[model samples]
Target: MTAALRATGVALEAASLIALRQVALRSRAEPVLAALPGGFATRRKGHGHEVADVREYVSGDDIRHLDKGTTARTGALHVRQFHEERDRVTLLVADFRSSMLWGISRAFRSVAAAEALALIGWQGVSEGGRVGLLALTPDGQVAVSPRGRVRGVLDVIGGLVRAHEQALQSVMAGTVADRSLDMAMSGLERLAPLGSEVIIASGFDDMGQGMEQRLAELARRRVPRLIRITDAAAGKLPKGRYPIRLSDGRRLRVSLSGHAQTQHETETICGRAALLIDAGSGVEQTARLLAANLPADRAP
Candidate 1:
C-alpha cells in the first residue's frame, strides 16, 4: 500500500493554488500567451455606446463616430471605435470521477484538472472577468457561481480542493462512480450565462451517452472549450506483464498480449478544444498551455 501510494500522485490543497494568481498576472505581458481561440482572440466589435478606441478617421469611417473636438483640434477626422459591452464570465467545469485519481507522473489526473482550472480561473479574474466552477466528483457535484476578482478565483479553488478530496476518499473505499459528464454539461446551461466562456476539464472516463449532440447544443448558447487530461500509459502499452494498484488500494499484476491503443471519444465530443495538456504536466506548464490560447488584450 505504501508503494502504491508513492507511485500515484496525491491530491492538492487549495493553498497550493494561490501562487497561480501571480503566474496569471505575469503571463499577461508574455508573447506566448498572445493567442486565444476564435471567440476570445478578438474583442466583440460593434457600434455600441461603449467606446473602445479613438483613432484618426480612415476611408469609409462611420460619420457619426467622428470626434468633433479631436477632429477640430488635430485638423483631421477622428473616429471613435465602439465595442459591445459584455459581462465577461468564465465558467470552469471539472470532472473528478474515479478514473481521474490515477496517473504516471507529476500528479493524478484529478489534481492536474484542478491545476488547469486554477490557472484559467486566475487568468479570467485578472482580466476583469468573473470565474466560477462546476465540479463532478464521485460524491456528487459541487457548484460555485461566477464572481469577479480574487474572491471568485478563491471560491473556485476552494471548490476544487473539496471536490478532489471527496473523490480521493471514494476511491479508497472502492465506491461506485455516480457522477456523469453529461450531467455536468447539462448543468452548464443553468449555471453559465448566455455569453459565458465555459471551459471543461476531464479525462472523458464516463462521458455517457449523447455527449456530442449535447455539446453541440451548448456551444450554440455559450463559448465552451475543453481540456482532455491524460496519462502516459493510457495511450499504448508494450505487450508485457505489469503491476498496478486498484482504486480500492489493492495491488494486482496484469498481463498484456498486444499493443493497446487508447480509443477515447474526446475528438467527437470536444473537437473545439485548442489545448490538450497531459496529466503529468505541472501547474506552470499547464497554465502556459492555457495562457497560449487566451486573448492577450483582455480589458482591465
Candidate 2:
C-alpha cells in the first residue's frame, strides 16, 4: 500500500471514526463538488419552525421571517433564518457481507465501508440534517432511525460497529449467507420515509437480480445514491497461483488467469449514477469521493 492509503487499525473502532469529524468539518471549507443533478432539497434551509440564525435582511429576504425586534433595536432590517421544520433525513445503508471482509490494502472492505458511512454521517450532522443507518450483515440487518445532531451520528457509528462485528463473526463461523443486497434494499424502502435521501455503500459483489428494479422503485420516492466499494485487485491480477485464507480459517491456493471483467452492473442499476471508491483508499480520499458524489444541497 502507498503512503496515501494510510491504513488505520485492522479492526473497527468508533474512536477512530469520531476523530474524522474534524476532517469532515474541514472538508466543507474546500469542497470538491461533483457534477450532479441540481435542485436536491435534501439540505434546503428556508423559513420554517426552528430558528437557525438572525442576520441582517438582504434583498429577496422573506419578510414573513423578519425579526421585527432585531430590526427595531438595530434600526435596520433583519431577518430570522429558520431551518426547514421537516428534518432532512439521510439514511446510510452499508453492506457487510462476507465478501466485504477482504481487502488488498488499507482497511478491510467492510471497515472501509464503515469509514465511508462515518464520514458521510458526520457531514450530514454538520449540515443540521438527520442521519440514520442500515447495516446489512451476512446473518441479518441492523437499522437505526433518523436522528439529528451528535446523537444521530453516534447512533450510526455504533450501528456500523455492531453490524460489522456480527458479519465478521458469521464469516469466521463459515455460516451460510442469509442477507443480500435485495433484502437490504427492501429494508431501506420500508424504513426510509418519503423524501428522505438514501446512500448505500456496498462492494456490489452480490447485486442480485431484483436489485436494479428495487432501486428504480426507490428512486420514485427517495433520492438514492449507490456507492460501490472495490479493492485494489479489482482489475486483473498477475496470472499465477496465490495462497489465500478462507473466512473459515482454511488455507488454499487459487489460480488467476488474468481475465477480469470490467463490470458496469452497478452503474446500469443506478442509471449511471453510482459512486466508486476503492477499499484501499484512505480517509482523505474517501472524504473527497463522498463530497464529489453526494448532492450539492447536502453539503454544508
Candidate 3:
C-alpha cells in the first residue's frame, strides 16, 4: 500500500510537469546544455536564431555552451533555458534519527527533508533527469542508482517511505536495530559508482567526536558535496525553566532563568556555529546553490 501511494505520487509529479516553463530561445550570453557530458550544440527543430527569450544571467553562464540551434531560431543569446529529460538519476539521503522529530513550527525535520527532496526531484525531472534514492533504514540504509526512468525514482522513494515507516514501528515496538552512520557511508560507496549528483539529507545528530572524525575522513577521501538540513529548535535554547522528555524515558530542560541573558548570548553564538556546520547544503537553503557555485564560464 505504501509502495502504491509512492507510485501514484510519482505519476502525479510527472503529470504536473506539463506546466513547467520552457525557454525555447537563447540569449547572447547563453549556450546550450546537454544531459550527458560533451553533448553538442544543435539547432532548434523548426526555427533558426531569429527570436530569443532573456532571463537572469548567472555569473557561471557560459557563452559557448549555448545551443546555437536554439538561438538560431530565437536570434538572441539570453541564457536561462529550462529543459526536461526522460532519464536522469537523483540520489536522496534522509536521516531518520530521533532528533529529526523536533521543531516548534509544527513542521518536523522529516517533513522538511521530504519537501526539499520533492522540490529537488521535481527540478531534476524538469531537466529530464532521473532521481535515485539512498536513505536510512533504522537497521541500516538503502541505495538506488541514478536511472533515467521515472518509475525507478518512484520505486526508490517508495522503498524509503516504507523503510522509515517500518523503522518507526520498530522503535514503538522496542526492537532497536544496531544502526549507525556506517550505513550511510556504505550506501554512499554504492552510490559513488554511478557518477550522479548525490544529495544526502540529514541533521547529522549522531556526529559524536568519533562520528565527526569518520565524517571528516569521508569528506577528505571521498570529496563528497553535502547539503545539510537544519531546524530552529536544533539551533539553541533560550534561558528556560521547563522540562523536556527524552525518547529513552528520561527528561531534561533548560533552566537558564537565572542566566537568561547569558544563555541567550551563548545560544546566539552556538546557533550560528551549528548552521555553519550543517549536514547537507551547509549554509545554503536552496538547491541551486550548487549550480550557482560551479566555476563560471572559463571558456572565454
lDDT of 2 by residue, 1-300 (tens): 233223353468789889989878777667575744333575355545678899998999888888999999999999998766435788999888877887766678888888988998998887778889899888888999999899999999999888877877776567845555786556677778898888888888767778878888887898777778877564668788989875445799998888875633235344646767777777887787677666436432
Instruction: Give the number of the best model, judged by lDDT.
Output: 2
Q: Give the worst 10-residue stretch by lDDT in candidate 2.
A: 1-10
The lDDT ranking, best first, is 2, 1, 3
Model 1 residue 80 lDDT score: 91
The positional error of residue 228 in candidate 1, measured at the CA in angstroms, is 0.5
The C-alpha TM-scores of every prediction are 0.73, 0.79, 0.53
Model 1: residues with Cα > 4 Å off, grouped in runs: 1-9, 33-37, 41-86, 184-186, 233-239, 243-271, 297-300
- What lDDT tens digits, residue by residue, belong to model 3 across residues 187-298? 4656743434455566666544355555445444333334455654433446557787655656887564433121110111112212112222221233333223211221
Evaluated at residue 22, the lDDT of candidate 2 is 88
Query: Can you give the lDDT of residue 19 in candidate 1?
Result: 81
What's the number of clashes in each of the models? Answer: 0, 0, 41
Sort all candidates by TM-score, best to worst: 2, 1, 3
Query: Which stretches of candidate 3 lie above 4 Å from their native place?
Result: 1-89, 182-184, 208-223, 233-239, 256-300
lDDT (0 to 1) per candidate: 0.74, 0.76, 0.45
Q: What is the lDDT of residue 55 in candidate 1?
A: 98
